[model samples]
Every structure is written in structure tokens, then in C-alpha cells.
Target: MTKIEKKNLAWGYLFIAPAIIGLTLFIVAPMIFSFIISFTDWDMITSFKWIGLTNYQTIFTDDIDFWNSIKVTFIFAIVQVPCVQIFSFLLANLLNSKVKGVSIFRTLFYIPSILPFVAVAILWMFIYNPDFGLLNQFLGFFHIPPQDWLVSNKLVIPSLVIMAMWMGGGAMIISLAGLQGVPNYLYEAVEMDGGGRIHKFWYVTVPMMSPIIFFNAVMNLIGVMQAFNEAYIMTQGGPDKHTYFYLYMIYQAAFKEGHMGYASALAWILFVILVIVTLLVFRFSRNLIYYEAEVK
Candidate 1:
């Protein structure tokens, strides 16, 4: 190789070396260690004793919370992912309009997504307060009684769904970008074919934006599966464990119960579930998603 090319290559490696090193030290190393530890019983008080598949067996057969966590997590994801995606897409459509001060509205909407979840949890807690919350006060104006939003088992999941919609501003921005990228020429062509707004949207816009929509949905699914901060900070899986997510279950096992091995097993199980689910989603979406490059 030429000296100049070799020097540039060295510089490129130099620039990425820290990232590689950090990943190895922080993420990859921990993952390997956790996998190994999942097979051993270690409570941080005693030496790890190898127990084969006992931890996995216990989770699948004996522990009730594992099953409950699976149900709760899947239900939460099923509700939250599609709702958040649809809401975000609608918001993106609105924000994509040529109206004045729309950028400000977009910014206002997206601000929630960037805020720390702890802060968001605390803010929502006040809003959900039965006695003097903004939501209750607003409801009072309409003569509606104050409701136990976070405490009631039936209302808690719905309350989290609402919070999830609020945070979907990030997805809105993404959708807006996708909408803007839809070719104007295609829309004009649709108009020439006597297609109305609905026709254009259903045919051209949807097909063109399917990739972005699919990508966001996949990410939303993954994010919902890994959900932790809100349940942890706000409800602590309260009101009869209605918000007890799988990640929270892992936290409880690892930190609260000090069952490191069991927690590790739970984590691995979650990992496998997410992987399989993601693959299934991708498989199902294969025909629905439109890629322009496929034509070429």
C-alpha cells in the first residue's frame, strides 16, 4: 500500500480505537461475563456454584413472576408500540404541513422524548395525583370525578400507555422526516391520474414511507420490550403488580433478591425472546415493506 493510504488507514483506526476499546470493556465483556454467570448460582455472598440449567428451569416451571412478567411485557408492548407509532405518524403529518409556527410546535412535541425518564416520571406523578393533579383539575371543570390513575390496576396500564404516547415525539420527528422525503413528483403523478389526497396517501405516500414506518415500528417494539425507567421510577410495579415489566423483574431478582444467577438467566431469556420476536416481525413485514432499490 502507498504510504499516504496507510497513514490515513492508521488515522481511521486511531479515531475508532477508543470506541472499540470502550465496547469491549463496557458492553461486550459484561455480556460474556453475564452469559457465563447465568449458569452459576452466585448471590454476591458466596462462591458461584455451577447449576447447569436450574435457573432457567426454575423460571419456566416454578416462579410465577416470570410468566407474569412475560405476559405483562408482551401486553404492554402490543398496546404501546402500535399506538405510539400511529400517534407519532399522525403528529408528523400535522407537523409536515406548511403552516406558520409549525416548527415551534414540532419542537414542543419532541421536547418530551429528550427529557430524562426520571424527570418525566416525577412530572407525570404530579399530573396523575388524584387530589390536585392537572388532569384531575381539568376533569373537575367538566364535573368528572378525580380518578386514581396510577394506583388503580385497570387504569395504571392505560396511564402508562398515555405517557408512552407523550414520549412518542421522537418518533414523530422521524416520521416527519420520512414524510418529507416522499417524492413530490409521485404525488403530482397521482394527482394527474385523478387521485385525491386519500388515494395519493394510500398508494404513493404509504408505499414510499413504508421503510421508515417499518424501521420505527421495529425500534418501538424493541424499546417497549426493554422498558424499565417509567415502571421503576413512577409505579415501582405497584397497584397489584400491574406495571411489572420483565426488565423490572430482572432488576428485582438481581438487586432486590440478590439472585444474580437467576437474574442473568432471566436477562438471557428476555434477550432470546426479543431476538425471536424481532425476527418474526421482520419476516411478516417482508412483503409489506417497499424498497426502491429492489426494482433495480
Candidate 2:
């Protein structure tokens, strides 16, 4: 190889070295350690004793809280993912239009997403307060009775879903990019074919945007399934354990209860479930996800 080419290759490696080192030290090492620890029984203070599949067995056969966490996580994901995707897509559509102050509107909508989760949780807490909260105050105008939001067993999941929608702008921005990428010529062609707005959207916009929508939906699904901060700060998985997400349970096991090994097992279970769900999403989306490169 030429001296210049070899030097360039070395420089490339040098530039990427920090990221590689960080990944190895932080991500790879911990993952391996966690997997090894999952088979043991250890509190943070005690030496680990190998327990084979006892943790797994306990989760399946004995632990009611583990099962409850699983159920709560699935419910959260099922409601949150679709709501975020659809709401974001709708907002993207609105922002994609040629309107005055559209950029400002986009910025306003995206503000909540940029705020730290802790801050968002705290802000929503005041809004959800039953007695003098903004939501109840707003409802009072119509003589509607005040309703408990995060404090109610029946309302906790829905409250989280509402909070989730407020942060939809991240996905909305991606959808806007996808919408803008759809060739204007396709819409023109639809119009020339005597198509209305509905036809143009259904035939051209929806198909062109399908790949973006699919990508966002998959990411949202993953995010919702692993949700923790909102439950941790807003509800503490309270109101009859309605918001006891699997990750929250894992957090409690590791930090609160100091059952490090059990927490590691729970983490691995979550990882496996996520992998399966991601694979299934890709498998099933084969017919649904459209690509312009595939067009003949």
C-alpha cells in the first residue's frame, strides 16, 4: 500500500478509537458481566452463588410481581406506540404544509421532547394533580367532575399515554423529513389522473412515507416497552401497581431491593423479549414496508 493510504487508514482508526474503547469498556464488558451474573444469587453486598435456572423458575412459577410487570409493560407498549406514531405523523403532515410560522410551530411542538425526562415528569405531575391541576380546572369549565390522573388505578396507564404524546415531536420531525422527500411529481401525476386529496395521500403520500412510518413505529415500540422514568418519578409504579413496568421492576430489584442477580436475570429476559419483538416487526413488515429502490 502507498504510504499516504496507510497513513490515512491509521488516522481513521485513531479517530474512531475513543468510541471503540468506550463501547468495549462500557457496553460490551457490562453486558458480558451481567449475563454471567444472571445465573448467580447475589445481593450487592454478598458473594454470588451459582443458582442455575432458579431465578427464571421463580419468575415463571412463583413471582406474581414479575408477571404483573410483564403485563403492565405490554399494556404500556400496546397503547403508547400507535398513539405516538399516528399523532407524530399527523403533526408532520401539518408542519409539511406551506403555512406561516410553520417552523415556529414545529419548534414549539418539539420543545417537550428536548426537556429532560425528570423535568417532564415533574411538570406533568402538577398537571395531573386532582384538586387544583390544570386538567381538572379545564374540565371544570364544562362542569365535569375532577378526575384523578396518575393517582388512580384505572387512569394511570392512560395518564402515561397522554404524557407520551406530548413528546411525539421527535418522531414528527423524522416524518416531516420523509414527507418532504416524496417527489412532487407523484402528487402531480395523481392530480392529472383526476384524483382528490384523499387519493393522492392514499396512493402517493402513504406509500412513499411507509418506510419512515415503519421505522418510527419500530423505535417507538422499543422505547415504550422499556419505559421507566415516568413511572419512577410520576407514580412510583403505584395505584395498585398499574404502572409497574418490567424495567422499573428490574430497577427496584437491583437498586431498591439489592437483588443484583435477580435484576440481571430480569434485564436479560427483557433483552430477549425485545430481540424477538424487533425480529417479528421486521418479519411482518416485509409486505407493508415499501422502498423506492424496489420500484421497477
Candidate 3:
């Protein structure tokens, strides 16, 4: 390589060296270790012994709770991710419009997202309490009978979904930034073509904001799929394991039951599932995600 080109490459590597080191030490090493651990039986008390594929086989064939956890995670992902994304996008659009005290409102909405997850989960736990909780009291005014939220198997997942949506304002702020970055000239040109609000939005806003939407969708998908803290704090996977998400189950296996090998296998399975889902999203988004260069 040319001397200047080599220097430029050296500078680039220097700039990125810290990040590379951090990832290798914190992420890559742990991941490799975890994969190796998945093939052995280890309880933190005894030496790990190789067990072949028994742990994985048990998860697929014998562990009913494993399957149930998968079902719950799938349902949570299906329901919560789309709802959170749509709500966040709509809120972003509203905040993006010319409005008084928009900044104050944005800050208020985003506070929940910035708060620690444990705090948020605990706060929601109180709000969802069947007796003397705000939600129950509000419903009581309409003569609706108090219903167990976190305690009810039928309602636990949905309750958690609501909590997730409430704290989704951080994502809304990001979407608003994306919305603001969209060139106003696109809207102006569409208006010059005699386009109405719906037409302008359909042709301009959605197409331009699609990349942001795809990003948020993928993030929310990963978040919901690996949901643990909410279910752990709120219901403890209670009410018949109704809210027991995949990651929660993994925790229970590894920490609670001392089945580290089984939990590691489950973790790998989750990793594969997330990879496949992310790839599918990118594949499908190719046709939908719009680039400015493609528009003309």
C-alpha cells in the first residue's frame, strides 16, 4: 500500500482500537465461553462435564416449560413490538408538529424511559395492583369491576405490554428526530402536485421515515424477545407461568434451578432465533425502505 494510505489506515485503527478491545473482552469472549459452556453440565459447585447435546435435546423434547416460555415470548413480541412502535411513531409525529411546550411534554414522556428498569417495573407493579391502584380506581368510576392484572394469567402479558408502551417515549424522541430530518421540500413538492395531507404523508412521510421505522422495529423486537426484568419483578412468571418469557425462563434455569448447561442451550437458541428474525426483517425491508436516490 501507499505510505499515506497506510498511515490513514493506521489512524483509523487507532481511533477504533478502544471499541474493538472492549467488544472483544466484554462481548466476544463471554459469548464464546457461553457457547462452550452450553455443551457441558456446570453448577458452579462442580467441574463442568461434557454432556453432548442432551441439554438441547431436553429443551426441545422434554421441557414443557421451555416450550411454554417460547410461546409466551412469541406472543409478547407479536403484540408489544408493533404497538410500541406505532404509539411511539404517532407520538413523535404529534411532538414534531408546531406546538406550545412541546419540549416540556417530550421531557415528561421520556422520563420513564430514562429511569432504571427496576424502578419502572416497581412503579407499574403498584399501578397494576387490583386493589386501590390507579388503574382499578379509574375503571371503578366506569363501574368496571377490579381485575387482577399481574396476578391474572390471561391479563399478565397484556399488562406488561401496556407498561412497555408507556415507557416507549425514548424511542418516540428518536423517531421525532428522524421525522424532523426529513426534507420539508418533499412535502412542499407533494403539495405543489395538489396532494392532500394523506397523500403527502403516504408518499412523503412514510417513505422517508421507513428506515427509522425499520430500526425501531428491530430494536423493539430484540427488547421484547429478551424481556426479563418486567416479568421477573412484576409477576415472577406467576399466574401459571403466563408471563414467563424466554429469557426469564433461561434465568430461572441457570440461576434458580442451577441448570447452567440447559440455560446456555436456551440462550443459544434465542440467539439463533434473533439472528433469523433480524435477517428476515432486513430482507423484507429491502422493498419497503426508501432511499432518496431511488425516489427520483
Candidate 4:
């Protein structure tokens, strides 16, 4: 309990005060308010009316649309997350190699990641246009008929999944950083043990990269669950609501449908799902993630 120690501790707390305040104001406070709002039937124009668990009951028991949205979101997470991760990892591996114009290639690949989701959705709409789009034009060369991508119920989810990969450069960059951190001696040792490229990758690179892969997978899972802009901007949850994502449902409830309290309930439900899913991933990943520090 030295005077100088107390003064230094106070200074440290002062330095971190802004971050604490920001977190409370922006994240913690809103979460608490949203939880309270979820319990009441409060459309923006109407006075708040306490409804208890009616919203939850309706969503679980009666709302086919809500269940469909849940199904769609689950499918999106399952398919999109793995695809994006694998693609990004491969791209990172390619970019990690020493090659001419590699920096330019890296920049080109990463450019899509920085583009706004709204702009990406709009851009893809042109590409998916059946009449005279680039995709159809390409298919014409192969003598295949042009397909209505986003307009077809069966194809819409897949189309969205494909479009989701556009921003995978962020994950690629993270994978690249992880790759760089792998010690050169490990690969050299693997090579000395009659290990070929595949062997080295599977035995050395994969285990070393597991931590990064796990990190990227968890983050992508969260983001994909909350996907909105693509479904909203591109498809508007169209083609018989096949592309309807959960966040789009929430947006419609909160803003377009004027069901703010219902939307708040949906938001809280989604938050719980996100937490559960994330925890499940972490729990299962216990045996998979490898740390160099843990080996010794």
C-alpha cells in the first residue's frame, strides 16, 4: 500500500477510463435496454405494453417465417463458414509464397474484403442477371442455358453463399499472418523426414495453423449468423422467402413492419444463439487447437 503504487494504479485506471466508458455506453447499456424492450410490446409509435413471453411463444409455436429464418441462418452458417475459411486459407498459402508481383496480387484479392456489403450485393445483382449478365454470357459459351441465380428459390441460398466469399480476403490476411508465424525449422525438419508437400502441410502446417483457423472459424460463424445486407439489398428475402436471413427478418420487424419489441426479442434470441454456437465451437475445439507453448 505504498503511496506511489496507489497513484500509479489511479493513473492506469484514468488511462483506460475512455475504453470502459465507451464499452458501457455503446455495448453494455444498449444490451440492457434491448433486453428490457424485448419484454414489452412497444412499437415505435405505440406506448410500451408488458406482454411477458408472448413474443417468444409466437416465434416458437406459430411463426413459420421465424422458423424458416432460423433454418436459413443455420444452413448459411454451416455452408458459408467452412467454404470461406478453406478458400481464404488456400489463398493465404498461395500469397505466402515468394513470387513476382505477389504484393499486387495480394492487394487485388483483398480489395473485395474492404468493399461495403451493400455495394457488393448491388454488384452481384448485375452479375446474376439472367438476360445479359456476365455469368450468363459465360454459360452461353459452354452451350448451357442461362439460369436465374438469385431469383430461383433453390439457387438463391447458394448464390448468397458464393457472394459471401467475396470478402474472404480479411480471413486470408489473418491466415497469412498465422502462416508467417510458423517456424521455418519445423518445415525443414518435416522435409528431412521424407515428408512431401502434403505430409508437411498435414503434419506440421495444419497443427500449427489450427489456432488461427479456429479463430477465423469462430469469427466467421458470428458474422454469418448476423448476415443482413446481402439478403436485404440483393434479394429482399425473395423467391418465396428462400433467401430470408434472420437479421433481415429483424430489420423488417424493427423498421419496415414497425414491430420494435418483437424485433428486440428476436435480437435477444439471436444473441443467445450466437453465444451458444460460439461456446460450442470453443468447447469442441479444445482437442483441436494446438499451441507451441503447450508442447514443451
All candidates: TM-score: 0.95, 0.97, 0.94, 0.97
Q: Model 4, range 47-146, lDDT digits (tens) per residue?
A: 9999999988888898898999999889888999999999999999999999999999999999999998778877889999999888889999999999
lDDT of 3 by residue, 107-173 (tens): 9888888899998888888888898788999999999999999898788878988998899987898
Error of 3 at 262 (Å): 1.5
Which portions of model 2 show Cα errors greater than 4 Å? 1-4
> Which stretches of candidate 4 lie above 4 Å from their native place?
none
Which pairs of residues collide in model 3?
none
Report how far off residue 221 is in candidate 3 (Å). 0.4
The sequence of per-residue lDDT tens digits that candidate 2 reaches over residues 1-296 is 99999999999999999999999999999999999998999997878899998888888899999999999999989988988899999889989999899999989999998999998888889998998899999999999999999889889888999889998889999999999999999999998999999998899989999999999999999988898997789888888999999999999999999988889999999999999999999998899878999964
- lDDT tens digits, residue span 183-215, model 1: 899989999999998998799878988999998
TM-score of model 2 (CA atoms): 0.97
lDDT per model, in order?
0.92, 0.92, 0.90, 0.90
Tell me the deviation in Å of residue 44 in model 2: 1.6
lDDT of 2: 0.92
Candidate 4 colliding pairs, count: 0
Ranking by lDDT: 1, 2, 4, 3
